[model samples]
Target chain A: MEHTWDFAAILANWRVLWVGLQGTLIVFAATVTLGLGGGLLVGVCRYAKTPLLRLPSMAFVEVFRNTPVLVQIIWFYYAFPILTGIEVNPFLAAVLGISLNTMAFSAEIYRAGIQSIEPGQWEAGRALGMAYQQTLRRIILPVAIKRILPALTNRGIEVFKMSTLASVVAYVETLNQAKLIADLNFNPIESYTAVALIFFAVLYPAVQGTYILERMLRKSE
Target chain B: MEWNFWAVMTDFDLLLLGLVNTLKVTALALLFGVPLGLCLAVLRLSGARLVSAAAAFIIEFFRTTPPLVQLFWFFFALPILIDVRMTPFIASIVTFSIQSSAFFAEIFRGGIQSIDQGQWEGGKAIGMTYAQSMRRIVLPQAVKRMIPAFMERSIELLKTTTLVSTVAYTDLMFQANDLAQKTFRPLEVYTVVALMYFALIFALSQLSIAVEHRLAKSGDSTVR
Candidate 1:
């Protein structure tokens, strides 16, 4: 095949792609914050002794962790409205699906981190008259969070990649915009290639940094 | 609105066919991915610097890019570039095989590296070549440790097959789209399909956990 590659069309549609890039960033920022923050709460609940807190949190983690994110997104976009008499837009659906899924996955990571801490640390906190929440906040979580930084970073990377799944429901993200560019210019090669490069360019450095973080953490511990 | 699951049940066969296709693609991808991953892992650990560097680049490139983008590249772009007809099934298989291989390669590397140096030296003492040692001694041990990680990645690959639905492949998710449009029951159809996926995936996850526990009990140190 002697096809000449032309990236000029993709370059010409930079404005369209830029808007999509902004949408992608917004979704990423929203979901990553919500996901990780909610994950901590769910993680603590999963660790709680009360069945009321622990059972529901366990179920939440299992269901969200096991199911495909795309399925969750589609369900939210299509079914949630009918079930609740509430309308769901593309952005809200995407945010709910991605963030909840991230929450489930990261909850497990946080739980593992907490479990890895020595019992003595908890005892010392109680000895100092710290309540459960205070111990979790001031001492246990501070240490647990550091130990699980790499795992949490990996989850964050997955969240960024998952934001593209928003495009499935007609959300105007990078891949959706790339699809538009491909359709407009008959340049799938350049359009899709650009999107792939954009993701790789953004994530490759983060992944490398994770390796460095892991090694440093290992040495310190 | 009323919940009418019977509307979905009437078209359950379509969803079942979709589920079959989903598993088919996942199985095929694993068939290709595991061996390819082994090759990449070995190449990344090769004695030659350039060869190892090239392998590392491929692994990182695929690892970092989203599988959805890779699918579109193969389905829409590669055919034009290579002058070959691209089917959704082919594009899906090709994309996932390579994409999952990158992940599996890391598992293989970690599993291989986790082996003690004495094992390799013992292989050398027995006058075994590097390839022989890897094939006969090191890999046997490494693969046992890799089982949990391998299953986890496979489950991930299974979930990822949903992307094929975007390219109009009649996977479970795609079938749900069709049935919902046909029946005007997006709520029931999608809900049913989600449950179906949940059932399948949850079973697999429980099975993996069981295997991990058994491996741990057997005193085999498994890699994640």
Candidate 2:
């Protein structure tokens, strides 16, 4: 049996997918900001000498990192409201899950980057009468963040891909919209294929750029 | 807001079965993905331009797309395209096996490329064929160096298997949803299921870390 390929359904439903793209972009922007920004703070806590700061952050990273993000999303949607009497819409739940997971994963990345800096740099900051926080903010993080640019960029890409998971909660992301198109038009093949191609088009260049960025970093180092 | 454990306990057996199914999928996906990845790695490194380009396309396509999308495509779209009956179990396995294989291919490529050019030359000098050298010399060394990365990807694959639930598979996450609806105790059911995943994945993560440390201590240069 030969199956005929038809993209007319997808072409007609461009507006539906456009809305999904907006949703994806919104969630991706929100999560990437919260995830990476919060990650730096948690990463510093994980690196701190104080046990109070270090232990809890370690536990936070491990719990979020070890569990699957889908599970986290579902838990927030269905379980969290029961626990805290707070209503979580699908978007908020998805954002919380992906961002927290990214935080845990990127915290380790940031910590590793911070650890890679030399002790002499810290001493130099201290020699200039800088406090611990000031030295870290001024001396260490600039270099560390530059060193881990490729890694953080990769995390951002992962977050963009993860935005599709929001659809599991019926959040109107690209995959969810594709599902909608497939159902309404009875064109699963075209709908799903179009979604996959859309992601590849957006991400392939970014992935290639990462390869270039990594090579450039290696060269500079 | 009151907590209740007894309600969740009644359906505990179902969740256990779901956990078993989850592990079964993960184990099956790994069983298939590793060798497929090696084949992809070999093909991607082939001297023929078309063959290598085709392999690279496959890898990048799978890696860039979300696994959920791939799962949906396989479960929903593939049957219509291929005119075959598709089960959730089969779709989950096929999608994950292929998806993880793409990632594993990169790992294999890295491990193989990390080996010195001299290793290949040394094998050639000894009158060995390419396949002969690869099977006997390169793969054995490369496989060992690939262990840490292999294990890390496996851990990732396990976590990713959760997507199977979206297809109505009886994985732990699916079972939790079922149990929650049945018992009206979403909090207890989800928390417990999340903990179950945490325990299983955390143990594997620790085991991989241990293996990595041992490999590092034994003076073997491991590739990521």
Candidate 3:
């Protein structure tokens, strides 16, 4: 018995897939913004020696880092509306969930970056009579950003891939769309192979760019 | 606000069973992944360009894509391609093992490369073949160096086991979702599940840190 592969079913679903791809990009963009913004705050807390700032931040990072993103997304989507009297659609819920998860990871990366800066740099800032916050903004942050860019970019890519978990919560991302197309056409091979290649096309360059950036940074150092 | 923990947990046994399934799959995936990954790592460093290139491509392909997509492909497409049906549990295990192997292979490669070049030279000086050197001289040390990372990877695998629930594999997350739907207590059910996961991962991570410290201490002793 010979079975021929037909991509006709998959090709027909291109419009749905395009919408799903837009959903994926939108979620990725939103989460990256929210995650990085929140991560900076959390990372600052991590840099603080006070238990007030550090303890809660540490707990937040550990809790998010340790749990599955799927569980987090699902939990957040279902739990958010219940806990708060407000209702959120799946897209918003997923964005919040992924952002918090990404925030934890990003904070950890940022903490590592902050810690990597020589202590003398801090003292040097102090000797210049810079306010603590100013010193952090002016001196520590620039160096930390430079030091952490590669690792941070890698984590960003993880967030990009992980955004696919939104599909499980009924958000129609690329994977969700592909699953739909496959289920409809009963043709998983063509549908998913196309999905995989699309992902590869998007992610490969980012991965390569990280390597390149890291090398360039190292050479300068 | 009335929090009925009891109400949500009415199907406690199902949840417990799910927890058991989660651990069972995690352990199974780890057992399958680590050794296979070690081989893949060695194969990549075997000085055979074609073999190494194939391994690299496969690893990159697996790494770049989300595991959820891979799981879906294995669950759905593989049966069609092979003309053999696999249970969701089997598909989950197979997918996780393949995915972890790619990650672990990279970790093994990094650990191996980080070893001092002098170690390899010393092995060669001792009239040992490359395989013998890796097995006898290099691997033991690399394994030790890689243990903390191995633990981290295992923890990641454990967390990833939650994905099986999406395929209705009866993992802890599946049970919690089931409980949530049954009781109309999504918040309560998932909270409990999340707490359980947090405690388990936290404890394991602390243990990893302790083991890492011990490994570092032992390395220092050999210096003395």
- lDDT by residue for model 3 (A99-212), tens: 998899899889888888888988999999998888899999999999899988987888888888898889989999998888888888888888888888899888889999
Best by DockQ: 1
Sort candidate 3 into its docking category.
medium
Q: What is the C-alpha RMSD of each candidate to the true structure, in Å?
A: 0.9, 1.1, 2.0
lDDT of 1 at A58: 99
* TM-score (all chains, Cα) for each model: 0.99, 0.99, 0.96
| Model 1 ranges off by over 4 Å | none
Question: Which candidate do you rate higher for lDDT, 1 or 3?
Answer: 1
Estimate, for each residue in B28-122, the C-alpha lDDT of model 3 and write its tens digit.
88888888898889888879899999888888888898888888888877887787778988999899999999999998998888788999999
Better of 1 and 3 by TM-score: 1
Off by over 4 Å in 2: none
TM-score of 2: 0.99
What DockQ does each listed candidate score?
0.90, 0.88, 0.71
Model 1 agreement with the true structure over B116-150: per-residue lDDT tens digits = 99999999998999999999999999999999999
lDDT of 2 at B66: 89
Cα lDDT of model 2 by residue, B1-224, tens digit: 78999988988999999999999999999999999999999999999999999999999999999899999999999998787889999999999999999999999999889888899999999999999989988988888899998998999999989999999999999999999999999999999999999999999999999988888887656622
